[model samples]
Target chain A: MSVAQATRPPKAPAGLTHAELNALRADFPMMSAQTNGRPLVYLDSAVTAQKPQVMIDAATRFYEREYASVHRGVYSLSQHATDLFEQARAKVADALGAGKDETIFVRGTTEAINLVAQSYGRSVLKAGDEILLTQMEHHSNIVPWQLVAEQTGARVIAAPITDDGEIDLDSFERLLTGRTRIVAFTHVSNVLGTVNPVRQMTRMAHRRGAVVLVDGAQAIQHLNVDVKELECDFYAVSAHKHFGPAGIGALYARRSILDAMPPYHGGGAMIRSVDFGGSTYLDGPARFEAGTPHIAGAIGWAASIDYLETLDRQRIAAHEADLLGYARDRLSEVENLRVLGNPSERVGAVSFFMSNAHPHDVGTVLDQRGIAVRAGHHCCQPLMKRFGLPATVRASVALYNMRDEIDALIDGLHEVNEVFG
Target chain B: MSDLRELYQEVILDHNRRPRNFGELEPPCSEADGHNPLCGDQIRVYVRIVDGKIEKVMFQGSGCAISKASASMMTDALTGKSVQDAAKLFEGFQAMVTSDMDATVGDEMGKLAVFAGVREFPARIKCASLAWHTLQAALKGAHEMVSTE
Candidate 1:
């Protein structure tokens, strides 16, 4: 077969049948709950994953009896809280295969990117420099660079994604030059669910002597992410995206690079000494995190990670693969229902649109049925424009999702087509 | 709600496909544009008022189902309404999205009643109220409704 004829859609794996998948729905306690008396089919995880009971209880337990302000005080409770807070950070560092000196906790991925942007982007970058990115990045990845560009006189340039939703390696190579300071892009596209080759991208950036920042907001939940293997200079992920709480995130920057960069914010916990002449700053992550940290949120996030660790990573990945493959196959039954991405093994997500039906209308009807799927641009407005679509409806899957849920989604698409046809 | 599916209802599919009054008025009699940069919703409302009465009202924009359908329903309901009466009606619709509406406000804003369900969705209240807010701005002689953030 020729190259044109060689590429075809992959067949669904036979690991989990719809019946078996339906039976396994009890794994998630929330799946048993109802919304307006309808079964809750949550498929908007790219926005933020729903928390498991373990993470919930971690926060609840802390608030109930063990609550105390961390990192400041002589009380025994304060010391315990501080240890838990630091222990969570140490766990986060271990999660990313990084040292404690390399990880800094902020509000979320947006703040993490902003921290690096305001610190390294402003201080080190200069005019004529370019921060390279792919066209398929979320606005969170794009906007932070734009801010730094506006401040430092450096420019923001985009690498193109092929029509099939994978990044164009030729285009990426063309975009990079001596002035390329940082290569920032999403590890996975929120809409298309295309998992980019981070290792290869980092290697390409390294060849050009530029650092890379992978927006792993989607990856950590689906894939086994290791920063050492990826060799990215700065990686960002929102805790909420990985079954954790909102309002807290982690940024992994190489210690050598962070050592040269100054602190972005100034406040309590970040100071070493304060004199009339000048003030000295704390080192490493403490210097970057310059406020009263989210102690409860950190503890809760660690608990979420703990919950995921109880399950087999390989099993979760396989189950998601089965659901995604089955969903893709089932949706193809519709006349004009076209699945967006063409990944060999998709990261358990599907994005598409019907013949004449707008995604917003589809989303509303889905909401009425108590099926929560994200609709519209998925925060990649430029990608939507490139695809010549106003928006798309996306149903992203997690470990808790099953094939029957995917069937519900496919059947819903059929109803949408019948109504609109 | 009967079918556990993510399909748009017949009513929504019809509104989305046809999208009543889905064009800009050439040299619009009175026009105002509003955009929700948060969700990338852009809408422009046009009104041809004669003698303090809205002789004609129409809209053209790109947005979610609630915003577009609400705008279409807005024009259909407010076509020949007196500007003063329409203002009160707009307030009723606003109350539906922003607060609770009494029977008086409810009956007065007929057909627009379809969007009463929007109140349950706090994040989507803005989607249902975008056109009404623009109408309010247009009546006040404002030119545009950009991000108020």
Candidate 2:
């Protein structure tokens, strides 16, 4: 089979059957594990995904046999390691429809955004300039801009979201005034599961002469992200959220934008030559990746991408959509339970509140039943404040998740009501 | 189920449902806000001290059952008690909740013994202790909010 044929599964039906899903779940060892003596019903994939055995093996193999410092040693082992690392980079870049030289690996999404804020943001923003963001952004997207705004005297402004948790496009356009130098927002909200119209937002920001940065942390895992198609100047994502190892992610920026920006950090690998005077820096992604990178994490992340490529992403999306619909339908039946948002389109996650119980209390009850869900602000305190909620219970799904798990979650919710009733 | 029942005993659920001394105290009272950044649980504790004794203690905030009940029960126990006794009780309460599951609850804890199950849920120790920590800050006349980061 050709490499493309090997990577891409043949087109199948729109969604996977129950048996096929169960077979896929076997690839993730955690699916069989128990929590608190009961079978674990993991519904917290939005926070971080459970890794498949292939990803784990890839990382373990790299550490155990192929470990070496890349772009440093002349030996065959180092060359082989360099080949694997670069191949991983190429895979990640290809997944996003970006060039290999345009992808720079960092610690995670938070660091990726910070890289742009400190490097690209500081270079352009000035006093009285504004940074436009939506109210549904995670703290990772919001705080980085605020930090840059504080340093550069640029004011940070937030566009409002509708009662249904979708961004108000009219307000977003209105906020993109001449003073707006950069528009940073999330492609998919981590809290509300609202998928923003990235292409539309990018066109609006561009028409206003503002550069756009998208937090793709939540989108990359659930959606088929094409940074080029989105026309976002910069895109950031985390590997851990993609069923890969933690502590590694990528920032996709066009070559021209990257070339114009100064290096985020100065260190050994990033420098071409050094002296007591100023040192010259390497060009492309190397300019930002200081020191040795997370070699094992990169390989593991590539393996995860490969694992995802083997399955039909469209089918996975359909399955998740079905799960979301089922969850919402069952949640509405619970007495006094309120689903937080009603966006026209949502994916992977659903958040809710029970009038009789605090989210934390509800989380505890669910835990006792071996159901795992996130109960907190979900790093979107501003969004929570807009809804007048201190916190909410968030249950997110992944491709490996099944409809029965949603049933288990609904049962857990009923238990929460009974316990706290 | 047993563990959940233990953590959310009838007394705790009742206290959470209708917290005692649930409103802010008027003037001559010192107040401190306690925030649990982890879960966004916020609590404000107020105390009016006169003649080295707590003349009145009240609290107002929003949090989980563990935290609200803790605050409610704390106010009930500290009312009319000497400031020194209140401090001692705070230390004991902290110890009881943080101790191992097998540790014995001290006789001095009295009704506060209901919280012994907190030790089993380490993630919840902060939830049960937020109000107490805020009370400590209020007693110390701290102007800044206390955070269980």
Off by over 4 Å in 1: A1-28, B2-16, B50-55, B95-125, B146-149
Q: What TM-score, to 2 decimals, does candidate 1 have?
A: 0.89
lDDT of 2 by residue, A240-342 (tens): 9999999999999878899999999989899889999879999999999999999999999999999999997868877788888888898888987999989
DockQ of 1: 0.38
TM-score of each: 0.89, 0.97
Residue B92: error of model 1 in Å? 3.9
> Tens digits of per-residue lDDT for model 1 on A7-36?
112332335556655555554567777765
C-alpha RMSD values across all candidates: 4.4, 3.4
Clashing pairs in 1: A412-B6
Question: Worst ten-residue run, lDDT, model 2 chain A?
Answer: A1-10
